[model samples]
Target: MTAPETVVPTGKSGIYMPRRSLLMRIADMRAWLFLVVLIAFFEVWSRSAYGVSFILNTYNLQSISVFATAPLLLALGQTFVIISAGIDLSLGFVMGLASVIAAHVANYAALQLGLPPLAAMLVGMLTGIAMTIIPGLVNGWLIAHLKVPPFIGTLGMYGVARGAAYLFAGGMTISVSNSWYSTIGNGRVLGIPVLVILVAIACLIMHYLLSQTRFGQHTYAMGASQAAARRAGINVKKLTMKIYLLSGIMAGVAGVLYTGRFSAGAAQAGEPLLLDSIAAVVIGGASLFGGSGTILGTVAGALVIAVIQYGLVFINVEPFWQFIAVGTVIIISVLVDQTQRRFTGGRQVE
Candidate 1:
């Protein structure tokens, strides 16, 4: 049988080394690893200062997860937009809108009108989406057509979205009375909070899209070289528009979660989320310059921020120091991103 068709081992081409690129494979796990390190540190600190059991009580289940929700959502949203070489500064405001919309929809009147509890919940989130789409459209038009600076364009939307948020709420908070409405925000699945589940799933979906799909390839292509992407017939403008839209959609989803968790929608519902969200993306080792961030990196970044915040609180570190510490982390994260980019510097052929 011709020696049973003895075959030679293939080279790198045949190696199933890793289907995931360097960044995609560990994006979420990296975030979790950061969490693990923080947990270890906290365990040590607690042993030294408060004793191990006290540490356990302080590093309690609720505390760890509570700090994570906002940052995780915000990071995911920021990751996609930044990869497209853009940013959405209005995310906090969209979160505020989410709070308002959810509360507004939760109104007994809307409930009486036959709106399902889930539909009511969605209404709150829809505002985040609108804010994203509107300014994303603006950002796209300016950057793609008008050639306006992405920084200035998105920054302007930030102010505008915040203003609209106040207008929508007239500076008030709203809440829902439906028990079912509360279930989503406050419920658990397999011992994991629903919000956590949602965020985790989103990470998976985004990571896959970024790593495996044609659109993702085009996204990097556009960021790396818009002209080249156009030359490659990548429909750069459409991609830009879609990317911004996705950013808005994420913010809106976060809004829904926020509304449910707080059981209220206020004009300022999502303010704190802004810092952690951007911080997470930065921490995850994604370049703000587009063409570089991986979803895995963003998740890591988010966890980093969450851990810092959690660590500070658990160790009784001053809250103000948390802010200062996070700012420092952001600088460090950016530096790391720059360094990796420099190391990888070459004309991106694909």
Candidate 2:
């Protein structure tokens, strides 16, 4: 084999390379840097405002993890939808609906059918999954077959699902007496909260699905250009349906967690999670315009939001002010995303 000749820049480029390289790397890492800086700022502020112990407290960190699990799961599912250039406004309500259905089913199985706790729990979970999947399928059909816009399709489902939740529970809470169901959310594994463990497992699975599968590749392709993806032999309709289905399934999982944690399924559960999940996804560097995101980034984003919320509460900030702070962060995140898109000629960052 012939030896390759060395090639070198011959002009001003050579002088510029070393200096520009560092700047380019920093620019590429802006999202991660922003998250780190935000966390550091919160830690410092918490120490100053409350006490060093507040910032260093293991209990507070654990509490943040607990609070973060629901939103984290919702955001993970939102990542899939948004990556495919779709949105799911109904997810929060779907979670509530699923929770109610699960709780009611579990209660009936345990009390009426005289089933064992584990068996009743399993039955409830399956029912919840199926309930959420129905909306997912309907949303998919509306968007893919009926040609409804994703936003309109999901928005309509939002109302439908929420209404169903209220109706199912008679605008009240459905309590489940099964201790085994509660264990799913409250029990610990090796000193870690089971809810946190579920979140970790979900992140790992989503990371694998998004980073290593042909489905993931198709998702990016579809988001980038649906027509082009179809031309390239991707099953755009089926893929769209599957994406929404997965989102619904995740919402169902969140419902199960909610029911387990509270020992009751309230019709209003997951209402706040809608915006929080979107904020997490956006803060994590996913463009609303779609086609780019990562599960790891989303997890970091959730932590950032959780830290801000926890820090605010620790410093005794009013809840309204905390909401404002979160809103501001979300706006800044969107601006940053837009700036990045502009700089990159509208191409999504991988």
Candidate 3:
């Protein structure tokens, strides 16, 4: 009798099993492991420094929610652009411009046009989105059609958007009089902060977009190898434009939220978000080289940042030290990213 024929799994199953090992999975999820470690460290530190009850309080959770919301949104948007091997340096300035435009337009619509508060707020939201989107389109044109490097194109827009914000607000803060404007920033639903809820919803939507959509596949392909993606029939230029446009729209939404939180908009209001968002993205384990990122990771990174910030304040650390600490963390994150890339032969962790 012939020896029993041995059947070996080939193709998909063959490729998947080795990668499905526990060690491989752990290696793939090093970022999440780091996040968990950071969280545990912070939890211990906070309890020791501020007392366990204070650290565990619902109010403290709400405070972190407030601090994390803006950065979380910006990082989520940045993830889309970064995954396509691009960056949007204009995000912070675009947000400032949006906030200024929204505040002024909403005030005008409510006071001069005699619109209802809710109607005026809606107009403001639309204005913010438009203002933000226009710059994104311009950025797209510069980078895609004009062949400008993303850094240069977005850096130029960064300055232009900041200037526009200042010009629009006349170098002053524009206050919003309508109470409804603050609803999104301050109100809560079902005992959760509105900002937290918004962030959660955005995370879910973006997670779905990245994981389940063709656009996301295209994005990853482009990031992995632009030449390969082009050869495979991807429309590189249009996709690039759409990515930046989405980034700008998210910035606009963040702007509106900022205005709601403050009841006013200032030209420089979003300046701080620039570093924070980038830091969050990096800390979340998204490679600066692109092709890998996750919304959940970004959220965790945002929370980490917020926790550290609040924890430092609770421990009475000085303000300047906070900046130094954040900068240090960012550098460490970049180093970790570089190490991972080197070890993995440039394969990015997902």
Candidate 4:
């Protein structure tokens, strides 16, 4: 019997870096650079005094930046799913359910009867976790056991989850009755929005999970080929379940954060998030076909989407034009992915 090999070391500074290490580093830098350039671009545009008067408004800048943080979290989760040769349309709906949990926690009859606040929050988080687990399990079942196509399986789950959200909340907007609940969502840390901080933390954890963990290693292997992965003794079924489980957990967290910021829970919680998350993952350099991508790429993709949406508002563009702009961004990103695929595929053939 032999232990499975998962990681290789690349010596630093005095030693030449390995190609894989270099590629990974390049990917990380590219994602961060994308975000930096975008923020800078918008900051300059806001100061241009001629390009977009709306951009110059401090209140709008803060609002746009804060809102971007939520979608960015979704993008990070989507990036992981796509790289591992999967998709999750349920992220939007899962978020809605989580939002409901957050709202209902503070309103619990037991809590109102003098139960501790922390206990209520813990209860909410647990509920959110369970919500994500079921869909992920189903996705895993359909994809791994039933041999269903990832796209269609997840798309079906998407509709099912949204309906569940509506049912769970009785199709009405639910809000927290406590000031403590509102504080967590709307509060800032060191002059930065708490939601943005949460997104950054989520990205960091996910990056390490994808880049350094054993589970993450198998993720790529299974994505590269289930047959090969199984031959290598990797548990494809287990890994598939775990991956979708992770997607659900992340979506659940995002949902909670969004509920906090909005101070309400609604069935429509994450409707616009579905395509944007996919776009973020695609933009981050994760391929639809699976086997390649980084978390950094996802955050970058998300920031790009956020900037474009914000930039539109800054320019006083009509509200409806936002969809057109987002569609253009997604198309451009996918085109880039296809072009890269073709070039690499040709080289391999040659």
The most accurate candidate by lDDT is 2
- Candidate 3, 87-144: lDDT as tens digits: 8899998999999999999999999999999999989978987888898899888988
TM-score of every prediction relative to native:
0.83, 0.90, 0.90, 0.83
- Which TM-score value belongs to model 2? 0.90
The TM-score, computed over Cα atoms with residue i paired to residue i, of candidate 4 is: 0.83
lDDT of 2 by residue, 4-52 (tens): 7755766655554323346444544555666677667777777776677
Residue by residue across 161-252, what tens digits does model 1's lDDT show?
78877787777777667555577777887777777787888889888888899988888888777888999988887888777666666777
Compared with the true structure, all predictions reach lDDT values of 0.70, 0.85, 0.82, 0.74
Comparing 2 with 4 on TM-score, the higher-scoring candidate is 2
Per-residue alpha-carbon lDDT of model 4 for 1-350, expressed as tens digits?
98877445546434654234454444434545555665676677666756544445666756776767778777777777887788888889888888886677646733565656555655665676567778878987888789888889888888898888888899898876555455667877776777777777888999999999988888988777778899999988888878888888888887877777777876678888878888888777777778878886787778777777877667566767767866775676666556555644522211
Q: Model 2, poorest ten-residue lDDT window?
A: 16-25
Sort the predicted structures by TM-score, highest score first.
Answer: 2, 3, 4, 1
Q: Residue 56: error of model 2 in Å?
A: 2.9
Checking candidate 2 for backbone clashes, the offending pairs are: none
Preferred candidate (TM-score higher): 3 or 4 = 3
Ordered by lDDT, highest first, the candidates read: 2, 3, 4, 1
* Candidate scoring better on lDDT of 2 and 4: 2
| Candidate 1 C-alpha RMSD relative to the actual structure | 6.6
